[model samples]
Target: MSPSAVLHRQLHQAPTLALSGEGSYITLEDGRRILDATGGAAVSCLGHSNAEVRQAMIDQINQLSYCHTAYFSTKPFEELASLLIESTGEKMSKVYIVSSGSEAMEAAMKLSRQFYLEKANPEPQRTKFIARKQSYHGITIGSLSMGGHKFRRELFEPILLPNVSHVSPCNPYRNRKDGESNEEYIARLADELDAEFQRLGPETVCAFVAEPVVGAAMGCVPSVPGYFKAMKAICEKYGALFILDEVMSGMGRCGTLHAWEQEDVVPDMQTIGKGLGGGYAPIAGLLIGDKVIKTLEESTGSFRHGHTYQGHPVSCAAALAVQRVIQEENLVENVRAMGVLFEEELRKRLSDHPHVGDIRGKGLFWGIELVRDKTTKEPFDPNLQLAFKIQDKGLEAKYSISLYCGQGTADGIAGDHILLAPPYNTTREEIVRIVEVLQAVLEDVFGELKV
Candidate 1:
């Protein structure tokens, strides 16, 4: 292998190169064209080619690119914040923009801690956090500590931040039993969370963090009815805050602008990224609720944490335009409508395949869980890397579909599920084509495996 290839590649076995892209297709330097289904980890909500968004970025560049926060805030920054608050309604009053989701998550954790301390709850006792198992918050130390993804945390275990605990996630396909009713299963999971709180001494818990719809870690799994409500109640019963990491599930990916809205609950603090900028710019932010802000305002008067590029003007401008497009185009409504279509079509195309185990998702975000045996729900051996094989086949079929690959969907160590999150404004034709290509690729790869 060349030195650059040997050093920079994430996967040693797979080819790595993105020469350029347009619309939903990415082209390689070798002149290969492929459809981009997952939008590079669900970030590209507006798709790869949007002339207006591109021009927005260019115009902002002509005006100004970067200005340090100490000097002044730009029009784009102010307008973006205003637009976000207006859309999110009165609950999310303040917006602190950052460069990426991990930054947003770190800021949220620090802000949550500061909020508590500022509120005179200086009780050193409330320093612990509770996150769900099989969740991915981010890769930063604080967020990483809060995440329970086994593979992501394996090497960093010893040095990871302390006081983060985990409980069973609301996974029905694998965790739910044959006879367990939905209500019964939910009650069982809620009881397990309450048990964890008691085990940790609720007073020591600062917040219970979770993805409103668990992403990446568990394959775009939305909670089975009433899960988030029950979780919010538990967090409230204790004095802990509720922090929702919507970095992957928020910003209209799940039909609503905020995934928490579907659950009929609001988080004390929420982290959002991905579609926030529509992949037009690198931007993410923490939506601060009234209580958390009030605590800080009354006590500290200022948040203790700050980032150099907390709210860049150009990035903000791009995101502002992105949000405006979503609102003006009625894209969230499109997401809700097409989301149902995508899921229904996915089921029609792949539900009965011999190796297809479970297909679950919400809005435009979906996952196809592959298995060796559907009857027993037995996943193929991890060494087989079934997800990557399918992804390669899909790419060869001329689609740039993203495979949100992860081990441990089955047991935190083995199993493969491919996540598909198309653009919110994706046309019905595009959805149909995406599923069709996926069906063709999956059948080909799995059929070969069978032989």
Candidate 2:
């Protein structure tokens, strides 16, 4: 391969160019069609070539594509916000749209701080935040600082914000003690969080940030029952906001419009992306609770933050169309039904594999952890790159399927797992095929390892 002008993730190797995508498959320049099992990091919930979404974009472009939010707002932007708020049952009173999850998180952080400032008795000292270990928020500096993924944050540790702290994530597969009941484990984690707040001076903390279902960093690890409720109780005790980062697990990805809906705890603020626009357009947003909205309304009457593409009409149009399609087609219902099938198939096919350790997730999102010692739950050495190898092998001719792989689930540096988040509209046949290909890939890769 010749040197390329465009800088890619791997400078040494040029990735295969995708020619086009239809339904659940993407055609590459080499004329090979690969099953899109992961939806490009769980963004393409509607699959590729969605006619309705495409037409919505075209319609918006023909009318008006861009407008500065400071000067004016377009119909698409307003309508999208209204739809999102309605979906939340008006719990989230307003929305601040941005171009990506990172931006949405950045805004959430800023807004939290502003909310404190707008309080009748301002909390200038409340500048600290607490997030969980092995959680991913976003890639930008501010959001990255809020994230606790060890591998992703190591290089930037020296420059990261000093006010953020991390506690244990609700990963029962790894952290729960042997013979401990779920209730006991949750209580322990909640104690740890309470201790962290006291150590940081409870009055000095602004918010506790976390993903409802821990995404990439820990590979679809859902908290044990009552985990979020416990955490939220602690946050409320300390008078800090609870911010749920649902970029990967929300918007019906986990069989509900909001992942927090199942958790039974409403966040003071929430950030969502990925499935929001279904990869048709770049869009994400911070949803503000009524309390925060009222505080800001009574005080400054303006948020201190703004982005150039905060409410781009085209992105909003795409997102609005995606939301409508999901509702009209009852795709969330499909996700729940298919999710059951997906879990059953994965358990039936891969549960007995020697390297398979844990299988957990909700809705259409699932993760299979690969371990060196299943009994001890010892993760494969990071140097082995087992997850990447399986992913690459799956894309080979024999398998021809794409999988989302991640490392550092065990201790933020050593574990490997594959995440499967198929499109919401996936059929039974597609679910079966995905499992078949995944099992084949695991066998081939593990066979090479002589396991």
Candidate 3:
């Protein structure tokens, strides 16, 4: 590979060139295969180079590549929308397609704002949004404004939106009292949210947005039982929207196609991506529940929003095909069954490790939080960047595996964790190999640190 002009994530260092991908492995320019355990930030749910997704894109391109969405609607997107809505059993009455998770979240924010205006009563006073601390929505301006990640927000704090506020995340490992029962913990969190809503003057709040299984900041942490229901109750009491951001956890990554499906409450709006097009195309969407849809249908009859590639035909076709393959092959079922085995293997192998603090998540979305003292649940010093170090170690050919890393797991700035979200179609053999590589990589990284 020659010196390049591409502006990569790290300006000073060039990343290894991935020459090809098959199944769960990516072959670099030097021909070393690295296991894609994190699925490239949990995007490649169907893994890389899936033939069906490729052919779908090709067919759509040959027929229709680009059409102004304002002027026309595309078949692939229409069908994809129907497919998604049907997956929700029509609880989500419509789907708004977008190019990425950030776009979906941006749309969600806008839609929530519009929904209030379009309602029968039209409460224009609803201007505030509340999200949990240690949560990540997206990186774009509107989405970033709504996110609660301190480090990601600090640099742009002055310019970020001031209407959004943060609350404690539903993380028992860190937040719950030592003697707190799950029921008591959930009750306390619910009261806290209710208090926040009251403090904001319930009528002034538009929505309460959160991840069903938190990503990035909290590293794959799922809410406790009845947490969503309790939170949604607060939203309902306050007549505000309940939004779930599933960009990293939905579309079968968490056993079911929708992570909210397991939470026993339907969100007013839900954002999904990463797995939607399975990395074959850049795509994500917002699923609008009947409440919002009916509001728009009766008052405005149209969402006051538009994007040039609102429903890119090729992207939709690619996503449609990927989703069909998932359905046809019963891969979501595979996720449930294999998820049990994966969890078992991880706990069996790593449970006794001294530094491993907590194993948390649902289905294939799991996080291993690292701590300096397991007994005190104290995170390692942020300067060590332990999670990032483990990620780098896995990328080395000797270990030969990929792992997603995150910091600020304990707070919005302190803990470290590694995320494991392998493709849903992963085989038992591949799962075993992934764990083995992970164990080796962790050992190597820790051994070098001499901790």
Write the residue-wise lDDT of candidate 2 on 10-102 in tens digits: 888889999999999999999889999999999899999999999999999999988899999999999999999999998889999999999
Q: Which of the predicted structures, 2 or 3, would earn the higher TM-score when compared with the native?
A: 2
All candidates' lDDT scores?
Answer: 0.86, 0.94, 0.91
Candidate 3 lDDT, tens digit per residue, 205-242?
A: 99999999997788788899999999999999989999
Error of 3 at 368 (Å): 0.3
Question: Any runs in candidate 2 off by more than 4 Å, and if so which?
Answer: none
Global local distance difference test of model 1: 0.86
**Candidate 2: lDDT over CA atoms?**
0.94
Clashes of 2: 0
Error of 1 at 107 (Å): 1.1
Ten-residue stretch with the least lDDT total in model 3: 1-10
TM-score, candidate 1, is 0.96
TM-score of each: 0.96, 0.99, 0.98
Candidate 2 TM-score to native: 0.99
